[model samples]
Target chain A: MRVALCGNPNVGKTTLFNRLTRSSAPVGNWHGVTVDVIEKRITGTDVILADLPGCYSLTARSKEERITRDGVLFGGYDVVLFVAEVNNLRRNLYLLTQVLEARKKAVLIVNMLDEARGKVDLELLSTRLKIPVVGTSERAKNPKESVLEAISKANAPSLPYLNEVAADAVARRAAEKNISPEFAALKLEERDAFIADILQSESSQRGCYGCRGCDRDRPSALRYSYIDKTLDGVVSCRRRYALTDKIDKIVLGKAALPIFFLIMTAVFFVTFETAKPLSSLLGRLVSLAAEPVKNADMPEWLCGFLGDGVIGGAGAVLAFLPQVTLLFMLTMLLQDSGYMSRVAFVSDGFFKKFGLSGRAAFSLILGLGCSATAVLSTRGIAQKTARCRTAVVTPFVPCSARLGVFTAITAYFGLPAITVAALYALGFVAALGALKIMRLFRASEGEDALLMEMPPYRVPSLKRTFKAVFANVCSFAVRVGSVVLGVGAAMWLLSNFSVRYGFTGGSGSSIMSTFAGALAPIFKPLGFGDWRAVTALISGVAAKETLISVISSLGGAGEVFGSAIAAASFLIFSCLYVPCVATIAALAKETGWRYAAVSAAAHTVTAYAASLIFYQSARLAQIDMKLFVVIWSSVVFAAVAAAVAHKIYRVKKRKGGAHDSAARKERK
Target chain B: MNLSDYSLKRGVIVSVGCDDDTHRRLVDMGLIGADFYIKSRRGGAALIDYGDFSAVTRNALAREITVRER
Candidate 1:
């Protein structure tokens, strides 16, 4: 048996779905979180539960709305569960009435009653609607039993008590088309495009609904009236949680954005402070374990490889697990507590000024966890170009892997903790700067207007939060243990061996250094032009997977960069450079490969330019011209590149002007 | 009056001024013809609430929605 759960956006449908299926669905206190229909089979039964995207009143306009509409209309189901937010029944009832009108085996699920605060007479509600109504809690241990039972005993009315216009249209259209009145009326009520297209020849300029003089407002008003009447007898809401309101006044108000930055800083401080000790402890333990491997009587080369390349690389990734887990936990808390939506809501003002939506902050926040996943999460965004633009720039936000590199480099240099914090801060500015530059100049494709509901603030469920943290950790571990491990081993092999797989005298004679030597001159201006620095840059394309291994093998960041200025420049370049190949693939999937390539090339070139500016400015200010010849070459290289870019821009502008004039003439 | 016009004041929705794509979406969110509580207004956006839910809307989009002083 196939059961389908459907409801309005953010109405706890997903929460209910998760509990019933014992699966972790991404639950956030915002609309359009579930953009695709996900199916999970109920355990210990032959029943598949498909959770459809939320919609309001079945009037399908956007793609997500269409998914819900199409699923309800065509996705064959034995039972239809309409999840309703208990506190928002006025709006929830509108959808419930629509489903009951379709005469499907429908049940009304009043979700989040534990938080409802208002008095609700479920028996009275069930009696009034003549449907099987069950109340659910987000933390309910046995929610599936009552819901499955309700499905077996559903008593949905055959026809909704419709507005007069719908009643007349149903009688008229049903007789004409030889279909049941309920089906005809429901289709007409939905203003379904398929129905309109079929009936268009007979109808005039107005659609089938409008031609029949059945305005959308009337039926919607009728639904609201029905809800008001039913609720007056069955429900009473007194102020449930004044604390939520009090908190929102501060968090969602005029002072919120500045306070939000502080809060985020605090979250990072807590995450790193708590996780740092344990991370180092794990690192030491791994080192201790590897000492035994080093002592084993294998080939001297093989022992070094096993002890350093394999164990050391894997240890670096494992050490990062604490930070990754904490980051995920904190983010999920913000998302669950409803603070994230408020932050995004307030940010709409700023992001819109830069031609992005407030929702871009959501992806940016997710990027702190993983850039590849963050780019994919923007699928719910409605504007095609805006979504693509957001995805393209998301990598600049610095994922956990990049954070690991920052930690390793800072610790290796014994730099102040403030330096690592500065890098995290730098990421936000860089991302917003990239967004501002790249998102402009595109032809105005109509953008998705910010229409998010700021859900009421609530306490995050720890069980759910911990479960989310666990899932994230498991996935992060798998990626690190597999992809990162593979890349690390490959990097070690190439940097260790000659072209004939002969073990080199040192990394200086390896095949990797030859490749690095060719790339070194290009980076001479930014100060980290050594062959070791070149290999770290090359391998960091896969991010921390190869960066730490390659760096340690090259005798560490201090030896590679040689000076604090050069080290800072190299760190800044690494921080702002192209994201890993996995993130690039996600970019390609979100936008086309052409735009992905453009985005990557733009990031790499600009990172070099910015690094040059930072390095040269610092050097010139300090009057340090010890390597005057190398420093002067960078200035010349930058000047030449700038001149070439200027020429290209002018030529493109001239062509564009001529094209615009020709098009204007043709119009005239 | 429009939502942008009543920046810090509470109002009941009188009518929605635009009827394109924005219309149905606003209605879907239950922002039409309902009593509203203005929470905050900043940076060309207003955070407002109907009795059951709160929403933050761009003032440009909010201008398309009209309301009556409560």
Candidate 2:
């Protein structure tokens, strides 16, 4: 059986699909999460279930809607499972009405049944609509037997009200194309651009081919009226302020921006702070695992290969699993709860100023976790320009891979964790700055206005949330095992063998060192030009964690830096240098290699320039302790002064408004 | 009144003069003949709730929509 899940945006279609298929298709509590056709087998049954992107109707107003229309029309399906939130019964029926007219069989699963108990008359609905209606709390509900039974016994329901002219036009088109009459009729009635083009090609004549459809704007209203009439018989919703509305009164107010920042800061704190001890513990465990392998009386090369080449390389990457999991889970939680939309919705104003849209916020936040995945998420963005801008900036944000490098290097220098936080902050600042610089040469175009849905905040499903987080963790582990381990093994072998094919184990006289030494002079101007620092950066392009291991193997970073200025400059270079091949491939997949190549080149050039400035500035201004403390105090005082002045200005403005109103009253 | 005039207020859409593509999308997205409420307004975009549907629309697009007091 080929079962397909279909619904309006944010209506738990993907949630139920995830549960039924045991697949993680990135169900966020936002609009347009699923943009492509996602199909998987329904276990224990000979069934293939597909999830289509959400659309309000059978119309193609956006990219996702187009995908949905094509999928449902062309992808032959045995059954359509029309998933909808019960509280949204009226809106749900609009699509249901259209689908049942064309589709063979469907089970109406009223998700969020907990909220629609007495208000929904299911039996009356089942009778009126002439279909099996199953109520489910999709937030946390098991598959009911009725859903399966309904799928097994597939039958088309009675067709609802259809305009005579529209039906005839649709039937004629269906006869010509030999497609489903109901689906084709509705698509033609709705004036679907794709269907019109298809019919246009079949009929070379310019005259009207089939039935004369209603006015362009009439079909949608007609559908809404049909839905309203259908609901008048079986559904009743009491007008009440929902919990989401009450919460929105505060969350959507002026304090929303600060609240957003606070949430992000807390996430950062939890990820980095909690991952510290856990990372150390993992590193210790890896060392313990390696001890026996090292002492196993095997040949020296074999032990070295097993110990450092495989175990050590994989271990270095795995040690940061804590941070990776934390970041991934937190991002998923935000996405699931629907705050991610609000964050995007609110940020549109600020982003518009930088030639980006509010939708870019989703990709940027995901970038903090992993640039490769972040680039993939940009598919959710609507506009082409916005998507491109988002993909280009994604690599500039420090990803989980680079985060581990930053943490490891910070610990090496005994720098405060705050130093790492500052670098992360710098990444965002640089991203926005890069947007401004990049936009200068291109023809100026206004940013797309935000047209996003703000889904009601719901408690994220723990099962699905953990499922997504675990899937991400597994992917990261697999990458470490394959890509990072391979790169590490190659680096280890190159360092151990000389160009003359002699094994000089400890000395920096091997092919790797020789290759790195030649490149060292190129970076000498930035202060940290040592062969070790330069070599680590070259390896970083393969895998970021490889840089950490490479630095360790090529005599420690401190041994290369020799001063705070050089160390800071090298860290900055590391922060902004070329993203790993995985991220580049992801970017290429999303846009094209032309964009991917530009991103790689931009990062490399920007990294060099930024590092030069940092190195030269630090060298020019010797910061004594007294001068540092004085500068920090002055900045703190200025911030406090600005806040007080803003408060006073607000107070005066309110008073003046009151006085002006009183004067108007006196004149009256 | 037009949609932009009903800031932070709830009303029912009377009619939408969709002279352009954006307003056409609004009507097609089920924004017409429904109770419309604004949650917030920022950067020329109004966050609104049309019945069970929620969306953010640019103020320019909102001007094309007409609404009546509920």
Candidate 3:
């Protein structure tokens, strides 16, 4: 049987889906986590269950809601498991009522019942709704069996409030469109933009078609009145002092930004400082594993391939596994604890100034985990312009794959924490800066709506946290096995073999050098213009982890850059350059090929210019500090002067235009 | 008064006067003719509790929702 799970946002649909399907799709304690439909088969049954995005009602507004509406209404599911949270059952039941009005077979699952603590009378609820009701919680030992059992006997309840006039209108619409009267009732009653467009197309008439005088709010009002009556005896919510209120006072208060900063600092400390020993141990283990090949009395070329190409390259990236695991764990904690929502809530105003909503915060945070996946999450953004802008800039934030590269390069500077943190901060600033620049080109589409859910804070589940971290580690291991291994071996072969001297076993006059040499001069202004740097950068486009591996094979960053300033410039360039092919493909999928190509070009050009400026400034400082200070002051002064001049010019032009228009009007 | 102009935290929603899309969404959430509570406001967005759910809406939406202070 084909079953689908649908509900309002953050009602634990994904949690139930994971339990029933034995799959680990991501679950967060906030709304909009599942932006698209995900499907999986039940563990033992032949039932394929699809998890649709959350919607307030069948009348879709946002992209996510549209997806859910289309899927639930027409995805050919045998039954729908409509999940609702106990705390918000009234609002959730609004959607349930709409589903019933549309004549869909659905079973109501009142979730988070543990929090309800017997306040909800499931028997009464089931009796009133005339459908099978199952009360469940995250701790339910076997909710799947009960849920599936309920689904097998799914039925649609009658919404008795469709009066004669409404019934006639629905019937007329049904006859005209050849659709079911139940669906027609919903379409005509809501008469939302989507339904209006459909009606407009159904008739090529210039005027509103099918239904007239059907008040848009009447259906909702009637349904809510019915719901209030049904819920009157079914629920008895005692007014208890909520802890969420107390927490919000502090979390969403004036100090929210500072607290967020402190929390991020703590996360970084745990990732870098606490995990340092584990990373060192892993590094030593990799070196020990490669020692046997280094000591073997084999052909020099074969030794280099085995000892350096495969083991050394992959191992270098692998050494940072501890940091990656810890970072992912902490990020999941913040997400699952519900603190991330507050951050979004607090940051909304600041983000709006840059032509983004607070919703972009989630995408940017996820970008720290994976740019490709983060770009996909931008679909939850309500405004198309905001979504497009967010997708374009998500790659500017360094993802986990680039972590190893940053750590390796910054190690040469000896202030790993400070330098790495500055680089991350720079990435965020650059992303915001890009958005500000994008705002100049694309006009605002009015104020973007943010009807966000503020889920009560809960202790993040340990099982989910570990599962998420394990997934990250598994994906990283897979990359090491495939992309890193292939690129490492190929780079090693190219650098070691020459056309004339068959196996030179070094980079001298080799195929890799010849190609990299051609690309070196383009980066000469950034100070790391060596052929090895060029090769690592090119391999990085394939996968960021491959960059670190190639760097390890070509010798460490210390050998590649040779100077502190050059290393810093390379780090900045890496931070701002185009993301891996996977992210670009994801961007293309979310936006389009034209946008993806242009964004990639924009990122590369921006990275190059920034790196060049940094390198030149650093070189100037090395030569004479006074000269460096003077040049920087002059640039800053000139920029401010230009901005002021432009503002004055625009003001004068506006005044002149007003005067001319007034003169013309007087003459008329 | 509209929700954005209501100084008191607790109120009752009178009507929603937004564009069709946003008005429909607000109505679907049962915000009309229900007890409303403003939980917080930041960055021109307000977190409102109505019926059994709380939602954060931007100021533009808040301004279009008429309410009577409790």
Candidate 4:
């Protein structure tokens, strides 16, 4: 049998779905975390459970809501597991009433009753609603068995308001359409345009007519009135959590943004400084593990290939797992505690000026961990244009995989904290700048306003947090063991061999150099034109971590860049270039290949220009301050002139297009 | 007065004078026809407590919601 979980947003529907199906489907404390229908079979059973996105009403306003309404109404599920929470049972019941009105066999699961201030009479609720109702605690432990049992005995709920408010319409529509009166009543109540039109046309075909002057608000108010009457003595509780209110005072107050930044600074400190020793120890262990291959007396070429190319490159990436794990853990903690939603709330004002919504912050912040998953998370943004714009610029927010390269380069420059922070800031600024530029082209598209609920804060579970961190680190390790290792071995072979000479170990005339040499001049203006740096840049296309590994195999960043300015420029370029292949594939999945291709090209060109500007400015500053000022002034002046000209051209084009439309209207 | 202009912390919703899209959204969230207590405001965005939950609405949205101070 197929069972579907449906409910209002952030009411633990996904969590219960996870428990029942024995699958993880990304549950968060905030709204709209799951934007698509996900199906997974229950373990040791034939039943398949589909988790639908949360919606406020079955009337369907947002895309996510439409998906849920369609899935529940037409997905052909045998049972609907309607989930609700006791905190706001009245409001949640509004959607439940709609679901029940559709005449589906459903079992109402009331979650988070353990957190409620007072007890709820589940038997009374079940008796009044005429369906099986199960109450669950905070963890919802062993809910699968009870939920399955409830499902087996589920019955269609009978809400009196449906019959009382739209009796004639429901009866007529039901007889005409050959559907249950309950579903017809639901259609009438929601004032569904398609069904109502069909009913009106069919009635008109005959001598009679459909219900006249349907009032949309009357049915909705009647449903709520019924819910209020039913829950009058069944549920007793205080709505607000006092601790959440107190915490929000400090976290969501006037100093919210500054406090968030300070918290992130501390997290970065812990990730980098506290995890340094373990990272170094892992790096040394990896290097030492290759010592056995070197001493085995195998052929010189075979030893170098195995020790330097495979283990050396992949191991360099493996060593940064400690810091990455720490960062992921801290980020997950913030999200689990519901602080990230508050961050989104505070960021809305700033994000609004950039033509993005507050929810876009979730994707961008998750981009700090990994761009592939971040781009996938853009599903939560309802607006199509905003979702696309957010996905295209998300890669500009450096992912954790880029941490190794940033740390290595900045450590050499003797200020890892300052420089790394600056790089992160620059990446964020670049992403905002990209969004702003995109707005100029698509400014005519209407944007949706933000309306998000703030979830009450809770302490993150340590065990769950560690489990998520472990899963993420394992995924990272698998990437290094697979894609990074393969790319490393390929780089080693290409850099070590030549068509002319079968093998020229450490020679300048290798296949990789020749291939990378052609691209060197393009980057020479950015100051890091060495073939080795170019090779690292090419390898980064496979995976960001591979840049550090390839650079390590090619005698480190010092040998490649040779100076601080060049290293900085390379870092900037790496931060802004095309995201890893996996992220591109994900981007293609989210936004089509056309947009992904354009985004990649745009990023590369933007990276080159930004790096060139930075490199030349630094070079000039080192030589003469007067000359640096003169050269940069002319550059800025020319850039301003170009921007003004572009603006004027666009204005003229828009006016001309409007004129043509007017002329066409006149002729018509 | 409008919710954005209301200086007091507690208010009762008089009417939502927003356009169709915003009005439907507010209704769906169960924010209409409810007593509200303003928890905080920043950058013209108001975080209000209504119907057993808190919602952070944009400045533009707040401006369209008429309320009576309690």
Candidate 5:
């Protein structure tokens, strides 16, 4: 038997799914995590459980909506589990009504019963809706039992409830307008054209009839009346208890924001502080494991290859796992508490001035974890231009992989930790500026508004948090291990091989060196124009983290950070350069290779330009004055210039377009 | 009156004009009823102060919804 879990966004559908299937799907605080359907087979039964995207309705405005609609209509699931939040039954039922209309067999799983605290009249709700409703919670001690019971009893048939007046109105409108009842109702409700077309076709086939005043003429009015009548009989709530407001007050009140900051700061402190020892420990283990092999009278080539190429490359990636895992856990917790959504809510206005939607803000937040995954996460956005623009700007957010690179370089340069923070901030500012500029020129098509829900706060489940952190760590390990290993081996071979001259013995003698040398002159104006810097740039294409590996292999981390200013310049360049191969692939997958190429070209040019400015300014300043003052001046200048230029360009272009159109009309 | 004219500080009841799509959506969501309250405003998004469950909506959408301060 096939079972599909469906619900409005953030109705605890995923938590319930995880509980039922014992799966570790990332349960996000907001909507859109499960945009694509995920299928997991139940252990004991022949039942296959499909987790469909959470959607507010089946109206299908966004990709998530479309996916859910298609899944329900054609995906051939045996049972549909309609999950709803106990506190928001009315809003939840809006989508439930649509599912019922689809004539699919369904079971209502009213989750978050802990939040309900026995206040919810489940029996009344079930009687009124004429469907069996089961209350469950992720926090429940025996959630598995409740879920298993619900699944066992899922053989019950569907009971659709549509108010008599609304049903009559739909029928009347369908007949009067010669449209299908569904289409006529949707049209009255001001639904999208897709629904209109469906109704129009049906209406046209069924001949139109005249009515003095058909109920269909006022579909919205009829719908409201039907909903009101239904609620009057079935739904009830205490006037004093507002679930969302009460939860928000406890979780995100004025005091909560500061606490959140403190918690995040602690997380960062622990991650960075603990990573050094962990990295050292792992490094020692790797070297120790290789010692016997090194001592063995193996082939010289084989010893060097295994010892340096494989072991060294893998070590570089694995050393950072501690920090990455910590960061993921913290982010997951913030997400679970619903604080991240609040951050998006607060940051929306700030990001909007740059022409980015609120959803892009969420992707930026995710970008801090890993740019490739962050780029993948952009699929949640519906607008093509916004998604593409987000893809282009994501790399500038500086992922944890880049963080590892930054830490290594900073340690080498003897640069203060604050400089690292400053560099990250610089990247963020640059990305925001670029996003604004891109949006101004591109001018997003259609009216794309951001509508999001602020889910009631709940303590994050440890099992789920651990699962998310582990999944992220595993994926990162796989990526860095395979890609970095290949690049490392290739680099070693290239450096060791000689065609016309004696083996150069290092990257300096390799083919990459020849290319880097060729490109070195082009980047001389940007400062740090040595072959090593150029090679780092090239290696960065494979993966941003590989730049650090190349640097480490060439002359250790200490040599790369010889000077604070140069190190700063290097960090800036790395942060802004072409996104890693994975991100480019993701961009290609999302918006075609043409767009990917364009994005790469745009980012490379921007990075080069910014690095040139930074290096030149530093040279003029002579690194004598306070580093903070110099950094601040440059940042402020860039921010102002970017903001002004973006606004003026957009305004001028719009006026010019309008004027030209007017002139052409007059001439005509 | 224009939406900009009313001093609807988020948690106030407001009337809506017919042509605003945002207002229409709010009305559909049951935010435009006479007794609904505006809860809070942060970063241009307002939460409707529903007695039992609040609805958060964008300020641009809110402006389309005319409200009388209670």
Candidate 6:
């Protein structure tokens, strides 16, 4: 039997799904984490469980919402497990009522029972709603027994409620108007085309005509009236209870914010500083493993390629994998505990003023971990224009790859670690400022309701946290494995090949030098217009982390610290420059090439302009600005100019609206 | 008028339709509650105020919901 778990967003539906199926999918308190549908089988039963996207009602408002709607109505699941928040029974019933209306075999799983505080009258609710109710707390309780019991009791066929008179009237209308009862009802209710089409098709097949004897136009009004009357007796809620408010007071009251900050700071501190020893240990193990290969009677070329080029380049990235994994785990823990949603809510006021939704805050936070994934995460934002704008600015949010660059640069400049951290903060501030400027010209015409749920605060589970972290890290490793391999080999070839001289004695005379020199002038103002910096930026195209490998290959890892401040400036420029190719491609797929091109150009110019200003200002202040500053500043200046140009283009296009309207009309 | 302007508190079913942009989104998401409940409210960033228990920012919430205060 196929079972589908369905619920509104942030109801711990995914958490319960993970618990029941023992699957390791990432769960977030924020909405739209599970954008696509996932299916898995129960171990003992012939049951396949489908986890549908969290939606308010099955009415499709976005692509994710439509996925849930179609999954429920047409996906042919044998049983629908309706997950709801126990504390918010009245609102949860909105979707539950839809499930009943669909006539789908279903059972109610009231999750977060631990947080419910016995406020819900489950027996009364079950009897009134005419469905079996099972209470569960995803954190503290094992929902296995309750879930199994509900499934065993799911023998009855699904029968959704309709207002009695309205159902009869729809039936009569279907006969008279040649529409099916369902179709007629949906049409009368003025539901979306998908629902209307479903009903209409059913009625047409049944040989129903048009609305002849029935009042077809007034069906929705009559049906709602009928529903309102039924709700008078069946549904009741207490005004004074304020369960969520009380919970919030206990969890996120004024003190909760500080506690949250402490936890987040602790996560960053532990992941970055404490993980160093573990990461070094892992690096040593990898090096030791490679020693035997080096000692083997392999060709000199093979040894050098495997030991230095392949393993070295890849190991340089892999050494940080432990830290990345730890970071992901901590992020998932915060998310699972539901504090992340509160963070978004608390920060929404600040972010929205910059023409971004609170959701963008989540993406920017994720960007600090990995910009590519952060770009993908923007799928959760409902408004297309806002999502694009967020994508445009995301690269500025210093990702993990850039973090390595920062460390290398700090060592090069002999600056304090706090200075490196301050640079990161500077990048964040710059990103927000850029977003505000981008918003002025590219204001999102689309309106997105920023509805999110504050999932009841609970201590995160080690099992779930590890699972989520592992999944994210594994995906990142796979991506890095492929991209880094290709980039490593290419860099090796570029460093060895000299067109006229054949194999170059050193990297300076190799093909990479030629290419870097050709592009050096573009970044001259930022003080890093040399071949080494240029080559690093080029390799960064493959994956941002590849910059570390390129830099090491060109100037050795020791040079990272000697040029510390300039290197730091370079890192900042690299962070804000064009996103890796994969992100550009993804943006192209989501929006269009035009937008993607614009995004790339804007980032490159912004990085150039920002670096230029930073270098110039530092130099004038008598700060020991290094050679890398010139190149960095030039790139930053270009980025600013491109952003300004793009803004102007958008404004002009908006003012040229008649042409746009004509084009839209033509498309229609 | 903004949703904040209304006296409607929790548990009240408000009648509100999405403006042009939100309308397209609601139509896409299959959100049926042109009329629905005010699930919860806090002084800071209204949480899960309407439409299938989804959390919405107060700014967006201000534009999307209009309460029928009793």
Best by lDDT: 3
Candidate 1, A226: how far from true, in Å? 3.2
The DockQ assigned to candidate 3 is 0.53
Clashing pairs in 2: A170-A185
- For candidate 6, give the docking quality class from DockQ: acceptable
User: Could you tell me which 10 consecutive residues in candidate 3 chain A have the lowest summed lDDT?
Assistant: A204-213
lDDT of 3 by residue, A1-668 (tens): 99889999999999899889987888898888898999999988999999999888887767888899888767888888999999887889988987887678889999988777338889999988889999888876868788888988899877777543245654665557544575565556566556546544343211233231237667787888889888997888555327777888787777878888999999988888888888878888988999999789999888889988999999999999989999999999999998988878888889989887888999999999999989988988878888889999999998998888888667646755788888888889989988989989987787775467778878888988898789779998999999999998899899888888788766569999898989999999999999988998989899999988998887777888888889889888888898899999999988899889978988898889889999999999989999999999999999999999999999999999999999999999
lDDT (Cα, tens digit) per residue for candidate 6, span A1-668: 88999997777777877777888766876666776788987656667888988887655666677778888877888789999876566556666656665667778888877765445656766665566778878557667776877886763332233443255645764566443355345543543456445445443322122221123223333334433443454434434335555666555555755776687678767776777777777668767866776677977556656665677667766777877777778777777766777777666667767877677888888777777667767777777778788877777787776666665455445567676567667768878888878777866664456455555556677877777777778777886688876687678667767988876644578898887788888877786777767877888888887887666545454553234445656866886788888778867765678978987888888888878877666665565455556766787999999989999998998878978898899999
Docking class of 3: medium
TM values, all candidates: 0.86, 0.87, 0.94, 0.89, 0.82, 0.75
Ten-residue segment with the worst summed lDDT in candidate 5 chain A?
A205-214
Clashing pairs in 1: none
Whichever of 3 and 5 has more DockQ, that candidate is 3
**Residue A364 in candidate 2, Cα distance off native in Å:** 1.3
Give model 2's DockQ, 2 decimals.
0.39
Error of 4 at A541 (Å): 2.1
DockQ, candidate 6, vs. native dimer: 0.28
- The regions of model 4 sitting more than 4 angstroms off are A138-140, A165-214, A412-415, A444-447, A630-668, B17-21
**What's the chain B TM-score of candidate 2?**
0.82
What range of 10 consecutive residues in model 1 chain A has the weakest lDDT sum?
A205-214
| Cα shift from native, residue A354, model 6 (Å) | 2.0
Candidate 5 chain B superposition, TM-score: 0.54
Q: Which candidate number has the best DockQ? A: 3
Model 1 achieves a DockQ score of 0.49
Q: Which one is best on TM-score?
A: 3
lDDT of 2 by residue, A299-366 (tens): 87667767766776678668888988998899889888878888887887888777777788888887
lDDT (10s digit) by residue, model 3, range B22-44: 66677777777789777788878
TM-score of 2: 0.87
lDDT tens string, model 6, B1-70? 4466554554333333544334433332323334444444444356544433345546454555444543
Looking at model 6 chain A, report the run of 10 residues with the lowest lDDT sum: A205-214
lDDT of 1 by residue, A151-204 (tens): 888765753354343446546665575444554554555444455554442343
